[model samples]
Target: MKVVHVDYRINEKINVNQFYDLLVNSTLGERRPVDDVECLAGMLLNSNLTVSAWVEGKLVGLARSMTDFNYACYLSDLAVNRIYQNRGIGKQLQILTQAQLNKRCKLILISAPTANGYYDKIGFTNNPRCWVLERDSDISI
Candidate 1:
């Protein structure tokens, strides 16, 4: 078997189709807005940090995040093509993301139900108090 030589690029702007394709090929796609190109474009354009993994010019993993650099970082998406899932690319992507932050910033993410164990294995402490307000939910002033 030929060993795949993976290269990691930090904060490089990626083509939307490549990003969309990797998302769809990874397990995270099940929870992403894969059918909406505009939404996906906005996601890439607005994110403050992105780390991507490529093998022979093909995108195989990505970490997309939003952060203030000093307080908190919301790791909005972490995906690795199913074929590349077990080689530590995901952990390295997270590490690269953290490296761009201020020393005090805390990396945070809402684990996809299927990925909680994986996060635990990679040193993420479970925070049980996270709450969410869906975009469609009514709000009171």
Candidate 2:
């Protein structure tokens, strides 16, 4: 399948609604309404570091990072359509997002139980030096 990779350069330029729609329709794990995705997209778009993927004007994937543009970054919401999996689109999204970060920045992402291997294949690894403090066992509120 042919894919179009794009880096959105301006805030408010992408349709947040479409972004949410694609994520929801793709059954990429969680389901989000248009407004929820819109809010998330709005925040990411205003952020200095953000990236997205499209296939002929259709939003198929998205990833965003919060960074100092130098030291460290937290990558969030990396998602690709179920139909588009295994086509290297996920890797391309990561590469595109990484290109916008500073070389000194350490990237981090929380992988789903089944998706860890995929991220590992793309050069993301578990940090031996990091620790997570859990305040609650219930993830769902």
Candidate 3:
């Protein structure tokens, strides 16, 4: 097995451009709003918790989440640079994210289709009750 050296950071002040670049290099860019820098900035600003992995000061992996720090934590985005995948960087990011919350807090997330099996291997259970509301969707009375 190859050992990867990484530096993990929590709530580090990072620029949106770096995030955009990393996302663009990862599979996450496919589902993210990479064309909108404003949206990406908002996403980063609103997130209360973020665990990032850096290699030689370059952004490689990140786990962004929103939480109350006591009850529920929704991991909104988990992205690893394509060149740095399969080196446990993603798993470490999650672990660091979890460490910030209390034991009572539950970590939740909606996995990307291709990442479902990866989550399973990392000890996340499949929950089928998740629902999505698109921007164009309507709320019925």
Candidates' C-alpha lDDT: 0.93, 0.67, 0.93
Most lDDT-accurate candidate: 3
lDDT by residue for model 3 over 56-117, one digit each (tens)?
Answer: 89999999999999999999999999999999899999999999999999999999898999
Please say which candidate is ahead in lDDT: 2 or 3. 3
The true-versus-predicted C-alpha distance at residue 79 of model 3, in Å, is 0.4
TM-scores for all candidates: the values are: 0.95, 0.72, 0.95
Which ranges in model 1 have alpha carbons more than 4 Å from their true place? none
For model 1, what is the alpha-carbon lDDT of residue 124? 98
Ranking by TM-score: 1, 3, 2
Model 3's alpha-carbon lDDT is 0.93
Clashing pairs in 1: none
Q: RMSD for all candidates, in order, please.
A: 1.1, 4.6, 1.3
Residue 53 lDDT, candidate 2, scale 0-100: 67
Off by over 4 Å in 3: 1-4
